[model samples]
Target: MSADTVAAPRLSLNVRYNRNVQENSGEEEESQVEILEDEEHHADLRPQRARPHTQNNPAANNRRCFKATAVALGGFYLLMLAGLFIRFTLLQTRYDQLSNNNSQLQDEVKKLKDRTEVFKSCPHGWTGFGHSWYFKSEEKKNWYDSRADCQQRGADLVVINNKEEQEFVSELSKDGESWIGLWYEWTQGGWKWEWVDGSLLTEKFWAAGLPHYNGYYAACCIQQGKWTQGYYSDNKNWICEKMII
Candidate 1:
């Protein structure tokens, strides 16, 4: 009876020890599965490392775009200012050329006028009538003295060639009486009027019914568009005439 009882207790103890070892093994397996789950969750929650902060951030992208746009606009502004400066330089050069051309044209026109204008061709103090030049002397002188004065001046008394020339003298003699190149001389046909240059008096402008040969010699003097006979020694204003040289 004592050997059987001892063997039976030892068997019970072995069974209990084996049961406890199996429970501990199960608990360790469960803990290992929990640890694996926690590791997977941590891996999913961690931030990615491939992309940097600048690509995902909105403020950073906007600042980069603003910098690019500012650079582009500033370049355009500088280009426009350079183009304006170039255009202004070209316009200024063109204006200077035009001014030079205008000045040269003005000088040429003045030279042309000086060469072509007949009125300006006459000497000072002389008046041009048609193609002839005339000068009036304010000092009174006799006919012979007037003729000598005209000869000394390289001219002669005004010779009225036509109605136009007669009018010219009439207007010129408006202020006072003046001697013309005409005189009466004793001829074979009695007395006749003649010019100082030995030209015939075919065209005459004698005032109404007057050639009154009261004296032996006669000369012509003009006064206010009228002609009167006077002595060769009569003192009167004189007119001198010559062709334009």
Candidate 2:
């Protein structure tokens, strides 16, 4: 009985061992297939290395160049605008200075015109003729005293300039022998005729050979337009003349 039992159990155990080994090998193959599938998925998820761009892209290069050129041109334009602004400011300052100068000139011109207008007419107590005034003295005195009186009245003895002025004086002084501006005095260059204004006599209205005097100096008096010499102390009426203001 024992022999038969042991033999049957050993044969069953050997068959079970072979069947378990086959099952385990099938599970291991399935697990290996799953692990391979997982590796393939992970490789797909990893970032791929980018391929180098060996050939030049003309469109991209042109875009980069255009950007650089635009920046440079913008900077140049900005500098030009700044320069123009500075120049305009300088011009404006110069224009202002010119305008001020012109205004000052206009004001000066106006003042000159006003002064010209004010000097056009003569004052009172004087008779106007040409650009001067004349006064006839009412009192009689010596030649020296007559000249002094004329000076106190802001004038001097009358000085006849032309034939017309001599005629006028002759007509005005016909009443008496009046003291005239003509006189002869001894100088370094001998005796010569002079007027009260320090000018040498150029024109003469003398009664011929009547200006002769023996003294070192002498005065002249005018009865009419003709001139004659006399002593400086001789009494006479006098005429005065002054420039018109």
Candidate 3:
């Protein structure tokens, strides 16, 4: 009541202390805006570092394309086992050249079948059928009875003319049979062949129908058919003549 009421109480206590300081600054700016919105919501919940794993990824390029297709299938199975070892060494060198050409064609077919069986048992220049000369026989003979008593010794009984004179009369009849010249006479009527220098019957190596005179008998001469086809009474196997020196 005396100096203005003591300065109105000290300005009303300084206006209530500036209104409490502006209401504590406004509650500290609203707690700093809720702490900046919780630090932007924890920076959007974390975790991001995983992107560094690359290798151009599509599952790491499909595991490097399956290890380059298993090394190109092991180099194509080692080139098919070296082409089956060069086709089994060219089939064992063509089976040893066809077994040496079949053993040289079986030794040339066994020497051409032994020269065709020695030209079918002797045969070359044989003659008879006429009259050369005398060839008679009455034996005390024994050289195969003087060669079958010379077939009664006559005109055309021994004539195997070739294979080198039938191996030279089978080596001179080996141990027996001899007298050889040839005879047979009775002329013109039919049986005629004499050759021992007297020459007559022109040259007839008969085999077919031979000196036929069946009944009249004088069939003197001509023998050797145990393998060529000729016969008179069958037994005499002679005839290996050769004269032209």
Candidate 4:
């Protein structure tokens, strides 16, 4: 109705409209801020879901490491077992060789003992000359000269004490006459043997028919095997007997 009344009404209407627009704009901005905050929260929660699987990767890595370590330990144990097997094989081979050597040594000792027994059981004869049971001199000499040589060396002309000894000596003599200790004793009026140590002959071991003393020509001695007959003047091989000390 009046100008002032009209101006006051228009001002009131404008104030009411600005207030309403400010209130509505403030409400819309608050809603947009709430929505943005909710969206950020949801984004953070999505990453957390993936974080659980990412954390499990370290545990898987730890399990794989444990498996690798276990495999290494097993390999080491196998290597140790292989080394022990090799050592055992070597020791077994050495032991076998030593056992064989010991057996061989025992056999050799037994053979030596048997040979020694055979020598000890041999009959009383010239056993100290050489390895051979009987031996003949290489050179020839008369009976008296041969007896003198044998006597100087603590030996005597081979004397056959029994048939066993005669057979053994006869095989060693050459196919010729040899000098022995048998001789004719003019004072005794019988055939006598010039025994070692100047002892008289009590036991006689002659052939079937021997010591006839035909012209006192043949001079010989009884060896292990046979009667060796040689001329007194002729030089011939002789056998000497030596006692084993």
Candidate 5:
């Protein structure tokens, strides 16, 4: 094509009609040919350039809608997972608390059962406290003889366990000396004392400066509601005690 034809102006139909009216009739045939070629070229390019965007619009819209639906479904699944995890955690924590409460209740029931067994073991004329029995003796004897008398009756010399036991014995004595189960052991130390049950004496209510040992053979006795050390051969009214099965 010539350069002038390549750069030819693209005019509307109305502009071409006006140009034809103003120009000489001698150039009419040539002008008509150029306008006809320009129109044909424009018609070809209009279909080529515009057909792709128009045909693809529906497909582009469908792709955008599909992406939106996928995003919404993914968010819903994430929310469901989070809710399930939270519920599982709450249930596990509740189960642990219930387990702890059940264990505590079982312990309480066991204690009650043990206490009932101890109460059932008490015989006539014997007082019950904890898991043992107590008896007040009316006769007098030395510490060793007192223990022997208790043994004859299937019992032993009394062991004072706490303030309540000491008070019970003091009340029964009514301000007099009584042989009890505490004695020194040359098996360990000159000063070591323990109950007959082999348990060490950890607490005692003793008279002031009064556990004065008469050599390595001292025994304990209850006097005026307090513990006092005495010779093993000393004579006093005694108390007997026994343990439940």
Candidate 6:
């Protein structure tokens, strides 16, 4: 054996070992790349998780709307009821006042009826008429004082009922103006003529352009078969009447 021949075999063995190591490393790299690609494909095919969501309830929303509408309607009805109550209260007060006035007038009529039972015929100086007695005053006085005089004599200012009575009273006062029972009074429809017994005038016998006085200070007077209005404070003659029983 020669030293050169031994060295050549050792070099050939080293070259074979290096080639095998490079081939093993290349195989390992290819295996690792295939494994990574498989893992990515499996991850893409996996199931997805669901997201959170919010829901709405239509019935609950309608109920809330209905409650709000009911509350508003109830408030409107309450306001109407309050207004009606106030109106009723005011009407009741007015009715009570009218009732009291009516009662007072009825008492006065009753007293006059009682007085009628006492006089059977016309008095000594009074003139006789249908179912009543009449008296004409000679002196002049205001309407209030004239009424006072008649009341003292158990009579009142004359209230002419019909055309005949109207004519008779007018003839009786042919001399000058005389106050009658008719006077302007306060009523629901404003000032109007009413008799002393609290009765409204039904028949009228006004003069030409007469009965035209204004305000509550007016009274009726007879002049030549016609009626006229004058101030209640005017000095004038008056007629009185007492009912016969």
Candidate No. with top lDDT: 6
lDDT of 4 by residue, 1-245 (tens): 68878798777955654565578987666666766899999999999988986675787889999999999999999999999999999999999999999999999888667656656765554353322233467788877788887777666776655556555555556455566566655446565554544556555655457646633323334443335344577788776776542
lDDT of 4: 0.64
Candidate ranking under lDDT, highest first, comes to 6, 1, 5, 2, 4, 3
lDDT, candidate 2, equals: 0.73
Per residue, candidate 6 scores C-alpha lDDT tens digits across 22-65 of 77977566656666787787776553222112344678779999
Cα deviation in Å at residue 40, candidate 2?
A: 99
lDDT of 1 at 107: 95
Which candidate should be chosen as best, given TM-score against the real structure?
Answer: 5
Q: Count the backbone clashes (under 3 Å) in each candidate.
A: 0, 0, 22, 7, 0, 0
Q: Is candidate 3 or candidate 4 better by lDDT?
A: 4
- Candidate 4, residue 183: Cα displacement in angstroms equals 1.6
Overall lDDT per candidate, in order of appearance: 0.76, 0.73, 0.45, 0.64, 0.75, 0.78
- How do the predictions measure up, each by TM-score? 0.48, 0.47, 0.23, 0.38, 0.62, 0.48
Q: Which residue runs of candidate 2 sit more than 4 Å off their true CA positions? A: 1-125, 215-224
Scored against the true structure, residue 17 in model 3 reaches a CA lDDT of 48
Descending-TM-score candidate ranking: 5, 6, 1, 2, 4, 3
The TM-score measured for candidate 3 stands at: 0.23
lDDT of 3: 0.45
What does candidate 2's lDDT look like per residue over 1-245, in tens digits?
A: 88878798676855644554577977666666766888887776553322235556889889999999999999999999999999999999999999999999999888666556645554565565544577777787877888898899888988878877777777667776677777776678987877888888787888767667554223333544687667777777787888654
Candidate 2 TM-score, true structure as reference: 0.47
- lDDT (Cα, 0-100) at 185 in candidate 6: 84
When 4 and 5 are scored with lDDT, the better candidate is 5
Q: With candidate 6 superimposed using the best TM-score fit, by how many Å does residue 77's alpha carbon deviate from the native?
A: 79
Cα lDDT tens digits for candidate 5, 1-245: 68756556644535666577678665666777778999999999999999986686887789999999999999999999999999999999999999999999999888778878777766777777756777777777888899998898899988778887778777766656777888876556555677887888777878778665433222333555777667777778777888763
Off by over 4 Å in 6: 1-121, 216-224
